[model samples]
Target: DAGVTQSPTHLIKTRGQQVTLRCSPKSGHDTVSWYQQALGQGPQFIFQYYEEEERQRGNFPDRFSGHQFPNYSSELNVNALLLGDSALYLCASSLANPIYGYTFGSGTRLTVV
Candidate 1:
């Protein structure tokens, strides 16, 4: 079974530009969650999507949004990016409610220039 995968393993953006990162979940999974990890910090939950709808959202700003497709893949979109947005964007997949350990893809290192 194919595991989760993310595009543009690394990305660079300016302070005000918008960026979109993509993710494909593991085979047979239906839930996808996004996390942000700052240098020296643990990954912070941004949001989670299931059944093509957002199921849970973290304390991130309105500028952070996401979408999950019927295929169980997902994309994270960030607008009016700030320098603080520079971090590792991680995507994790689970079978259902995420009570189980997640399968995490290699994160996309985003740098706000």
Candidate 2:
């Protein structure tokens, strides 16, 4: 089965502009988790969606939000973005029961000017 995949391997935006990144989860998976991995740092959990509802969240502002589609894919949206928001946005997928670990996509590198 195809693992998770993200679009626009890289992105560039201004400090106050917004951006939207997309993701497709692996087969047989219904949960999608978004993560932010800054340079030289571990991926930080942004939020997770299961059954189209947010099941978990991390320490991030409202500027960071997401949505899960019925097809089990997802999108992360950042509003009023700041320079600090620039980072590698990753999407990970796992089983609902989560007996196994998550599978991550290569990620979309975002740079803010």
Candidate 3:
């Protein structure tokens, strides 16, 4: 009965650098979604992965990319990182779609210094 799990609880990157964050969804979940949360702000949807394909995307630059594996694990990759990319990266898992709600992890704290 493992819940959502995110790797590298914290990350530090330099401007122009690239980083990848990994996530393993909760048991029984098949859809994964990524979000960016800034201080005092609600989470902003980054993208969603289902059936190993990107199903939906939010307002973000091409620098942000993602991948989903057959086992329902996922990865979020950010390239040419900017200081503005500093935020909390969250991974949420749902049964088949997000409309039913999601179970989230603590998130990865990314600091772009």
Candidate 4:
């Protein structure tokens, strides 16, 4: 009965370092998607995964990647991070054919210094 969950609620990294953020989807959910929210801006879609395969991707660069496990959990990885990459990383989960809307996690706040 749990909702989406993200690990390392907050992280601090330096330029050029890599970071991996994790997320556990809600029960009975099979799709996982990632988003990035910069300060005042709304969440921007990064990518989506279903059935362990990436289904759709946004305008993000190749540095942004994700993986969906068989259990429906997921991970978002950012390589060679830049200060501009700092943002609130959000994870959303829902059924493949969503009835309502996706359940989002509290989000991982990444600070690049």
TM-score winner? 4
RMSD of each: 0.9, 0.7, 0.9, 0.5
How far off is model 1, as Cα RMSD?
A: 0.9
Q: What is the lDDT of residue 95 in candidate 3?
A: 86
Worst 10 residues of 1 by lDDT: 92-101
Work out the TM-score per prediction.
0.96, 0.97, 0.97, 0.98
Error of 2 at 11 (Å): 0.3
Question: Residue 86 error for model 4, in Å?
Answer: 0.5
C-alpha lDDT (0 to 100) for residue 82 of candidate 1: 99
Per-residue CA lDDT of model 2 for 58-85, tens digit only, reads: 9999999999999999999999889899
Q: State the lDDT at 70 in candidate 1.
A: 78
Clash tally, candidates in order = 0, 0, 0, 0
Q: Which ten residues in a row are the worst by lDDT in model 2?
A: 94-103
Higher-ranked by TM-score: 1 or 4: 4
| lDDT, model 3 | 0.96
Clashing pairs in 1: none
- lDDT per residue (tens digit) for residues 1-113 in model 3: 99999999999999999999999999999999999999889999999999999999999999999999999999999999999999999999998855778999999999999
